[model samples]
Target: MADLDRSSDDTSVDSREDTSQDSKLEFTEDEETLIARMYSLLGDRWSLIAGRIPGRTAEEIEKYWTSRYSTSE
Candidate 1:
């Protein structure tokens, strides 16, 4: 058993999602506030909004803003 080789070296191909649709997203209060304030201030301007939050991408900020706002209206 010790000499058997069963695992692939490519993590990108072998890895799978450990959770399902029911999995919850975990966020800090600061992250939540950052996104909220960015939206409130920038009104979904991806460039400006993403700039305010550290390490956030423009696409991600835009998607979150739209998803939250569209459902409320």
Candidate 2:
């Protein structure tokens, strides 16, 4: 139906917007150091870690940590 097509198009546009927003998220040196220190203390407590940093969410912090540290072995 036309409504179904419109919904799918809206979903694609929303996904694109989400990707752009995520790509724009970058951490500063101080923020990275803080994340490291917090991780050591908290150990996968992303909500707690995110609370210490301004303008960052738990999901973003966790994604960064996983991408930067996780090994694909």
Residue-wise lDDT of candidate 2 within 1-73, one digit each (tens)? Answer: 9999999999999999898786647788899999999999989999999999978899999998999999998
Q: Clashes in each model (backbone N, CA, C under 3 Å)? A: 0, 0
TM-score, structure 2 vs. true: 0.68
TM-score of 1: 0.53
Model 1, 1-73: lDDT tens digits are 4334344434434454333211223345786788888677777678887777666667766665566667763
Give the worst 10-residue stretch by lDDT in candidate 1: 17-26
Q: TM-scores, in order shown?
A: 0.53, 0.68
Best by lDDT: 2
For residue 30, give model 2's deviation from the true position in Å. Answer: 0.5
For each candidate, what is the lDDT? 0.62, 0.92
Evaluate residue 54 in candidate 2 and report its C-alpha lDDT on the 0 to 100 scale: 77
